[model samples]
Target chain A: MEFIAGKYNYWIYVALMMIGFYAMIAKGNLIKKIIGMNVFQTAVFLFYISIAKVREGTAPILWDRTVLYDNPVPHVLILTAIVVSVSTTAVALALIILIYREFGTMEEDEILRIQKNGSAVPPGKPE
Target chain B: MIDFALLFFLVVCAVAAIQMRDLLSSIMLLGIYSFIMAVVWTRLNAVDVAFTEASVGAGITTILLIAALSRTRRMETKQCVPPANLLIYGTVILLTSAVLLYGTLDMPTYGDPGAPAHSHVAPRYLEKSYEEVGVPNVVTAVLASYRGYDTLGETTVIFGAGICVILLLRRKI
Candidate 1:
């Protein structure tokens, strides 16, 4: 019981990660894959924030008579990571739009089929 | 009990988001998921991270997804998923999870004061941040002062991503 109680957060996040992973590979739509990737990234953020929590701690701000503060390093690092996540999401959505414009379908299998049959217009040519 | 509830709902949202055939619904569910995750971070005393998650994950990310969905199909097709592909993906995920679980077993317990993460540079920052940076918020101080270059790089990456999106979607080239 103690072991379970102590590490349940990790277990839950791992389960969350597996769900995201399954969606990434099992889902057919390109947008669904990107959603899965976002879920996976946020799960990792949860794990890091979980690690930074200190028992009987408050936020990492200097305040009167506050001794215990949560670790600030992870918070700092995750800020950068969150920015990166947003940037990547933007770029990925742009790519998805381009893929749809070119192949006329967002389904990964269909896109592959289009490419395989050589139906897609070649690069740098008007469709 | 509240943590368990939050986590349970989080997993539910994750599953529902993935399983939803409507891409817009999935995107909304994902936004909700991010909001809940941000709340969890706030409960964990990671206020700064929670704020960022709420802004980026729930706010900006959802908007971008909706914008993208407007340009693409909303419903996923019912084509048969191949068993061979499932098997390969399942094996890879299981192996990776196993390795990660093994690694977690040796990690310090949650909130251990003596954990390597809390013991090292964190202590110095917590102890000296006010004196050195004169900032009440240690997170801001560390992000802006100690890791200024990293934050600058992240800002540049966001700028680059904006440029890429404009270049890709604004023209047919």
Candidate 2:
């Protein structure tokens, strides 16, 4: 009970991480993979932010000398990470745009099939 | 607790986002997930992180995804044939999660003031930030002033990504 009371946050984050992982590894669509990557990244940010919490702490703004403040390091770290996530998402979408133009399908298996059978082979699914 | 409820709702959104047939709706649901995740961040005393998550995750990501969807198919192919080796994949995911849970047993409890994360440099920043940096917002001070290199690195990465996008998307540059 004690462990459960104290560590529920970690357990919840682990579950979220697995959900993202499952989507990333199992989903076939290129965009689905990107969404999964987003989920996975946010789950990680939650883990970092959760640990930075202190029971009675206020937000990291130094409002008064008597008040406890949450750890700011993780907040700073996650801020950078969130921006990085956006830039990566943009770049990935650009790649997806090119992949669509070249192959005309976003399904992972279809892309692989095209790779194996060559572009001259009509796509397995009729357009 | 309210936290658990929010997290449970977040999980539902996550599942629904990935499970949707329309890629557009999936992206929208993901925006909701990030919004709620931002709320969770505020609850955890991370206002700055929550702010970024709200703007970048919910706001920017949704717009980018919709733009991407314009160039591609919105509806996922209807064939729901389960991936091969799904059982093996499930087992692997579960085992890894179990190991991570085990590892968490040694970690400090939620909101432990003495936790390693809250100790060390965090205390120094909290104590000295106002005096040394004159920035009441510790997160901003740490991000832009104290740990300037991380911000610089992030800026470089964004610049690189922008150049990569422009180069990749052009028909003939």
Candidate 3:
């Protein structure tokens, strides 16, 4: 049990990753897949934050006296990453909305059927 | 020991991602695989790389996959074919693994105090960073001052990617 406890954080990250991945792949709903993606990304963020930790270190600021400091490079890089992620998410969500408007349904199979039919019937109409 | 375990987990996630029947599940597994890869980068002491991987690999890439999947259909199990592309994929994997393993042989031993990376430039930065760059963090000095051009390029790449995505998704209006 000690061994398991020692590695508990790592294990949790892995489990969360798996659950997110499973949801993204197994679910037919598009929004559910985006949620899974968000979970997966958060797991990676957790991994980064865990590694940035230092034993008994303070912020990366200097004082009159020298003191141990946790590394701040990772934090800086992550800030940039967050901005990029938000931009990408905005674009992706916009595309998803467009797909819904065109197909009138988010189901992949149904959209493909309409595409294959070459506009014989407008979307969301009875056969 | 932990390193090996993490690597094993990464491999498992990658395999599961490739083998999954549903496209959505495969993309999700790919995100998990990316997260594990970020963990591996952190374990290797590349915290910056780990952060970028977490954000780009897990976050942005996953959203892109979800968007693509929403336009497509869930793949049917009966539509799956035998692994006829196995030989080509196996060869590519073998070549990549070989190249990476060979490159590792030339790398300095992990955490070697005498390595050039820790000796010449890094020590100078650590000792004189405050006086020279007026920054407490040597990494920031290196990134913002010494390698400013590279950082600018990276920012441009992000902007370009955003533009490409907009062009692909947006209508005439």
Candidate 4:
């Protein structure tokens, strides 16, 4: 019970991660896969933020001269990660649009079928 | 009380986003998931992280995804599920979870003051942030001053991504 009590947060995040992992691999639609990737990234952010928590600690502000502050490093690092995630999503969405324009579909299997059959809609040609 | 409720909400949103068939609904659920994660970060005293997550995760990401969805099909077409692929993914996920769980067993408790993470360079930043950078929010100070190069690189990467998107989607390409 003590083990469970102390580490439930990690366990929950891990489960959340698995959900995202399953979605990324098993989902048919490309957009759903992107959403899964976001969930996976968010789970990681939660894990890092959870690590930054301090017992009986306040937010990382220096208002009081003698107050315990949670670790600020993880918070700082996650900022960059969050920004990168947005950029990645933007790029991914743009690529998806291009894929749609070229193949007329976003379903993975359809895209593969079109590619395999090598129809007139050869991808990457400036349309 | 709020923690349990919020975590539960997060799980619901993540699962719903995964299982949702309509692309629009899935995108909305993911937005909600990001918003709830921001709230959870706040509850955990990571206000800055929460702020970033809210803006980037909940705000811009959802808009981008919606824009893409509008340009693409709304419903997923039928595709035959492959048991072999499922087995491969399942085996990989199970092995990863086991490894992660093993690593977690050695991690410091949720809020241990003496954890190595806290004892390392974190203390010096807390000790001298006001003097070195004179910023009230140590996170901002560290992010801007101590880690300025990383932030600059991050900005460059975002700028590059914007350029890539424009080149890929715009008529100019």
Q: Write the per-residue lDDT of candidate 3 for residues B76-100, one digit (tens) a residue.
A: 2323223654455445545644554
List candidate 3 stretches off by more than 4 Å. A1-127, B43-48, B76-85, B171-173
lDDT of 1 at A36: 95
Residue-level error in angstroms, candidate 4, position A10: 1.1
Q: List where candidate 4 sits over 4 angstroms from the true fold.
A: A121-127, B171-173
Chain B alone, model 3: TM-score?
Answer: 0.77
Candidate 2 lDDT by residue in tens digits, A9-120: 8888898888889888888898998898899889989999988889888999988899988889989999999999989999999988778777778888888888887864
True contacts kept of 4: 0.84
Q: How much is the TM-score of the A chain of model 1? A: 0.89
Residue-pair clashes, model 1 = 0
Between candidates 3 and 4, name the one with more favorable lDDT.
4
Please report, as a residue range, the 10-residue window in candidate 4 chain A with the lowest summed lDDT.
A118-127
- Each prediction's TM-score versus the true structure: 0.95, 0.94, 0.55, 0.95
Docking class of 4: medium
lDDT of 4: 0.88
lDDT of 4 at A55: 89
Which CAPRI quality tier does the interface of model 2 achieve? medium
Q: Write the per-residue lDDT of candidate 1 for residues A10-125, one digit (tens) a residue.
A: 87788889888888888889999999989998888888898898878889998954588889999999999999989998999999988888888888988898889988753333
The number of residue pairs in model 4 that clash at the backbone is 0
Q: CA lDDT of A17 in candidate 4?
A: 91
